[model samples]
Target: MGVHGHAVGVDFGTSTSLVAARAGRLPVEVVPLGRTTRSFPSIAGFRGEQLLVGEDTDDLSGDAVIRSAKRAITQNLETLSVAGRRIPADEVITALLAEIGRRAEAVDQPLSMARDLRLGCPAMWDGAQRQRLLGLAEKAGFPIDETTLVDEPIAAGIAWVMNRSLFYGERLEGRLLVFDMGGGTLDIAVLDVLSDGPGTEPEISVLSALGAELAGDKLDQAIAGDLTSDLAAQGHSSSSARRPELFTALVLRAARDAKIALSQRAEHRIMLPSRQLGQLPMLTYTREKLEEAFRPQMDIAEALVWAALRASRLTVRDNRSAADLRVLTPEALRGDVDYVLLAGGMSRIPYVERRLGALFPGAQVFDNAGVQPDEAIVAGLADTISYRRLNLHRPGFDFIIEWEEGGQLRQEILYPAHTPFYSPQQVLSGQSDLGFARHDRDFPGPRSGSGRLRVRSTSGEYLGLAVDNQTMDGLVVRFGNRMDFKLYCDGRILIRDGSGRALHMRVDRWPVIRGRDSGRLQLRSAVDREPIVPTGWYMDKEYAPPIR
Candidate 1:
């Protein structure tokens, strides 16, 4: 899809970005950038009239640079100031993507660059954020139709599946918990893998998924806060805190390095490299001090894991603690977990690995060998054509409708947030299709505009409405009426009579779509981007035949 060649995986991180590409029968390789390195810092800046990315941001040493474009986009900021004038966040992110594309195409073999891209996103980002990011990438010049956005943790899990040595050759089975604590987000995925006989690849199924904003970047911020107090204790910086840019750069760099260093050694020293403030005294941090600063962060991480496990219907024992992470009792290891694939640089921390390991009694915890944690995600994302086709987009909003059936009233999930819909069900061995929920069946015509449906927010706030198109008012339901029910993938509900006519609602055009059928097939972001074709509209091979 590119003018020259093709690129498969693009791991857009908060603190860095990586790209991987492959040609026919070629091994997947990370594109070299920034002094022949595979990963580049995700820093962008506007110098003069030009936008700068990758190694170019090194010139912004004393100046203010757009630190985290990913975070800004996640917060839905319209524009960010580069130097002085405000530039749109979309333009900034696009610049980064464009730079990556250019670098990827400049490989030794000179990749022509395919238009199709596999973008890795945080598991917690909902449809709104996902759409907004996709729009930004499209504006940056990639083909939107060919691009496939996937959850970061799932990508890591796939990477683990591709390379199973991390399991210590124990023949991994049961629930494989993937805890990805990266620079900007913490994602948790529980997968069920089953092997079939000898030499055949296993099947991976998603059991449940959860994520939070808590991650390594948050720990850096917490460490930076602690540094401010340390400065107060030093008695030198208690006065000269004027140069904010210098302070911000110095603190962040020190925090990141100190966090990594403290993971292995008991003590680490941080030196302030601020030219404006001149050379300052080196700050020494012991493991005890680091633990003190990281306690709150670890508590938050524990809570996220707790919630993710509960969502997956897994229970934990009472002795789950990082400070006292010992061997799990035989009872504790019962039916809980088998292995945990720990991804991201943050997951390498002794506290994180041990703490997460404590939650799963008999599970083996694996992490980056050396500097490979940051490089692992992009490779998994670039494994093959299969990675690009894997789409497990669960709904974000909870939809429930009150209906009368068999002379009694009942309410259940018309569309559950955790249930993925209408994909190539043949890809999986055993899974239900959405065919039952959507069908044109033989039945009698409707008696009236009588179905009563109330849509509400997850917190019980009334937001969705069942409109009657007849008089342009709320729908009124009459008992014993036959109607067709459709739960759209984009969280829309439609009800029609046996004659295939919509009823029980009256309304003008919905937010960013046209016509009923078109609206049901389109998904809109929270920030309102250009409308895109819905994934649920059925692509080629929308159903896959399970391999026997």
Candidate 2:
């Protein structure tokens, strides 16, 4: 059987967002709230039951809407409960996602094909947050079975790899790092590109991902604040205290504009309408002045780059160590990092390119006027969805494991995580004596006995992770059975069943188990009930009228 139809790619950004699609035809860009493919201000406002988003939300009033909610998604350690209803991070994301969906298919055909959507998620998302994103996508009209989470940096890296032929005649060699500088976050990912032959998709291996929310928007705000303070100190004050708010907003807008202009020119002029100022003149911003004003933010950017380099499997070093050689030798790791694709609007600044060039000398940087840095994430993701629909690559493997007594793990399947959705007669190998244990609440220690197979149903119906210790003399194992047991492990995603292929896996001593802490497991009389739905504010689901 073959698959027909195109998939959609969604770039749900912090300060801006976009959606792109190519359904069995050339890709057509989709813009939100206007004809522009990329929409901004990322702020949403409410005026007596009228919901306003994007540019219109910039209008400041007491009934002004939410701003920079994406930043709060990771921080803002407070729960907002209004009228006995709780609002959560996922709920906000879902609202944004639904808005994007509405815009993408707003014109003609129903976006039913977008059931197979690819979403760009941040690299800094932890396991719990990742799951929450998955749940949110499912709730926002995207089917869980069809949606695939693509890391923003990874998608950008893939875009670079795919377009490598256009830039270079030879296949790409050496490690390439994708430094994604966006409005709200900076993500750096190290990708090891494997030669997949001519016209074949490159097999990408992500060595590491490190990111921080300190991006262009933060820098702009800092610069704006500095300018506001300096102007106020110069005896410039509004008769009304509320005028400062309007003045500050204008400063921020001018700061961002000047930041972009300074990308090509050394100086730019910022016009103050003279509404708030008592006859103060307009402000002219120079590149040198802006850079000086945002030095602290630049320092943070440098720190984030160093942190990303340190997190990689390999690092640029003068000498190689024995352990390092076993993983990725310094000799193999050392090379010129190529094509630092500027994907986000933040990278539009000239200083960013100059700083990146100074940081990694000898690497060529290219920026095209047509490649919308703000919209590249969605474009690349949309292209990736198109590639997948073409069956460009196959899914990987998964490892299904079972817990036994004595802090031991047993392989329940030959392959996992990458397994096919449903496959029958798939046999696996496991051992009973393999020490796996359910901690006893009362006794609090390892028990010396064999344990039965454990399986649990995921939020996904008809999907399960089953591990049996009682099959085929504990050697031959078969999957696709219904058995309920509590299987605990260090990582959440231990299985990826891709097709009938058995993923490579091995049972070994558990990493967290120690000799002294061995007795911490105690069997309780009552079993905990399975969660029908996720708990906490992060999983709160709410619906608001679609953005008009």
RMSD of each: 13.8, 14.3
Predicted structure with the largest lDDT when compared to the true one:
1
Worst 10 residues of 2 by lDDT: 423-432
Q: How does candidate 2 fare on TM-score?
A: 0.65
Per-residue lDDT tens digits for candidate 2, residues 506-528, read: 22111211123222211221113
Error of 2 at 440 (Å): 13
Cα lDDT of all candidates, in order? 0.58, 0.50
Residue 144 in model 2: shift from native, Å?
3.7
For model 1 the TM-score comes to 0.67
lDDT of 2 at 49: 54
Please state the error at residue 153 of candidate 2 in Å. 0.9
